[model samples]
Target: MDQGTQLLLILVVLLVLFLLAVIVFVLFSVFMKRKNSLLREQIETEKRYERAIAETQIEIREETLRNISWELHDNIGQLLTLAKIKAQNIEGGEEMIEVAETIGTGLNELRALSKSINPEAINGQSLIYSLEQEVNRFNRLKYLSADYELLGDAVTIDSKVEIVLFRIVQEFMANTMKHSRASKLEVKVQFKADALEITALDDGVGFDSENLFEKGIGLSNIDKRAELIGADAKISSIPGAGTQLKLIYPLE
Candidate 1:
């Protein structure tokens, strides 16, 4: 072969090698990008699954607590009421009267203890009733006022959801009575096509929630509760302005 031809042949071979190198590099980049993307997707899926499991466990615990509370309120509470009546009617001498007084004290203690553990602190007569019945009893309490409003029928929900909603309201009412100076309080629930919104507004001496508390168990529990049902919860508060918690949950 002539010298010029030989040089030309080598140039062509070098060009082919460079093109092959470029092709390999491109394929490698694509493979890496795809692998990274899949890994990210896998991480997200795992996080979602973890959250779901936690929510499910929380719900189970709430149901167990509720069932026990119901048994205490219904069966045990009724027996205490009957005993109280019987003791009140009993007649006897001074010692007997003293014994009756002791019995009366025991009955009162039983009732109070029942209130503490009884689910809802006041049982839900039906899905139609709000926590108002339970809150009413607290009305007589000084430095505390519980108010309620309605927009639609408060139907039955998953027992866990009900307890969460109930506890959120309970905590709010307690906070108001303990910290709020404003007497006016509002509790209302509005149901949308796919979600339920609950508003608990108190005109109490509102604290600077913006800076005061970040994530307390009370609020965290509420959020965790909403999360269980795949719902979203938002809390807005300001000093001298009451706290507002909006929970959005699907109807089903």
Candidate 2:
């Protein structure tokens, strides 16, 4: 071939190579873009699924807690109280004295269980009568010392809100007693103009909150309740410094 022909052939080959490189680069960019989009969509979908599951769990809790309360009231509570009355009425006999002692022990346990299940009585109202009432229930609980401060006028909260808040606080306090092994529980409620804020702080063993976000049923319900109430929930905890649960809700 002539030299000019050779040069033209080389130029054609170089153009084809350049085009091939650009094609590969464009394909790579498009692939990366698609991959990122897919990842984002997956994350969003996971969040939606988590929220749905949390709602279902909340419903289940409501049912279970209600049943427990009724069972304690109708069956366990009434039975124990009746037995105590019968024991006190027994005529002179060693057997009657032993029966009375048994009744006394049983009554004490029943009282404790009933308080935990349906504290509305010992609490003088529903577990969440006011912010103060909730704090009192917490203080009365064994192995948990709660010091609560209400920094605003006592506002009347709806019964539904009172129940949910009561349960949420109850669950957190239970966790503290069972797992956290904490001694001091601090609760605070502030009624803002447009919102109500509640905080529960414990000096106990905390855990990785990120991990709890996935498996902690109590925390999940707290979050779900906050969402249902058009509010916001936040929890922060480390392994040693203890945990804090913050709930904010609207006033009206």
Candidate 3:
């Protein structure tokens, strides 16, 4: 072949090889992108499944609580009332009067507990109303100086989110009453344009928020549940400064 023709042929071959390399690179990039996209979709699907299972479990738990509440209100509460009546009727002197009074107090407590645990009672009303009932019960039972305040205008919330929020507050309150030795508790609900904010705090001894899992407080599970509901739970605590949980739920 002539020198000029050989050079031209070599240039054409080089160009063709370069084009083939580009094609291979493009195909590899597209394949990687698709693989990554599929992986993300799979992860999202697994998360959705997990959330669904968790929600189902929560529903079952609430149902059980409702049944227990009914038992307490109807059977146990009725029995207590009957005993109180008998105690009041017997002429056992001042001791009998005190006994009757005590029984009456017990009956009131049972009624409060039944109402608190009943999911229908909590879900049948507004979130504010349900929370108000909890705060009132605390004050009535002298469990603590509980206070509830609402900020901004009240907004309608999904029933599922409302129940989860209420349960989270209930768990925190129970922990405070049973372990925190807190004398005062405060709960605030704020309705903003874009979201709902709930804050619950107790003026009691606090623990390390960083090591919450080590303490087995179940607040971690609360965090997970909040995420499942597309809410954010931020729990903070300092020794002697008490504990606080701030939940932010987006309004849809």
Candidate lDDT (C-alpha), each = 0.66, 0.73, 0.89
Q: lDDT of candidate 2?
A: 0.73
> TM-score for every candidate vs. truth?
0.58, 0.59, 0.84
Poorly placed runs, candidate 1 (over 4 Å):
1-22, 60-64, 67-79, 91-147, 150-163, 177-182, 192-195, 210-220, 223-241, 249-252
Candidate 2 lDDT, 104-151, residue by residue in tens: 776666555555556344334543344455456556555678887777
Per-residue CA lDDT of model 1 for 75-112, tens digit only, reads: 87677667756765777567656766766665555555
Instruction: Kindly list the per-residue Cα lDDT of model 3 for residues 1-252, writing each as its tens digit.
Output: 999999999999999999999999999999999999999999999998988987897898789999999999999999999999999999999999999999999999999889988998877877888889888988988878999999999888888878888888888888888878899999999999999999999999988999999987667777876866788999999989999999999987
List the candidate 3 regions with Cα displacement exceeding 4 Å: 93-95, 208-221
The lowest-lDDT stretch of 10 consecutive residues in candidate 2 is 119-128
lDDT: which is higher, 1 or 3?
3
How displaced is residue 147 in candidate 2, in Å? 1.3
Candidate 1 local accuracy as lDDT? 0.66
Stretches of model 2 off by over 4 angstroms after superposition: 1-63, 78-131, 213-217
Q: Which candidate has the top score in TM-score?
A: 3
- lDDT: which is higher, 2 or 3? 3
Error of 3 at 106 (Å): 2.5
Better of 1 and 3 by TM-score: 3
TM-score, candidate number 3: 0.84
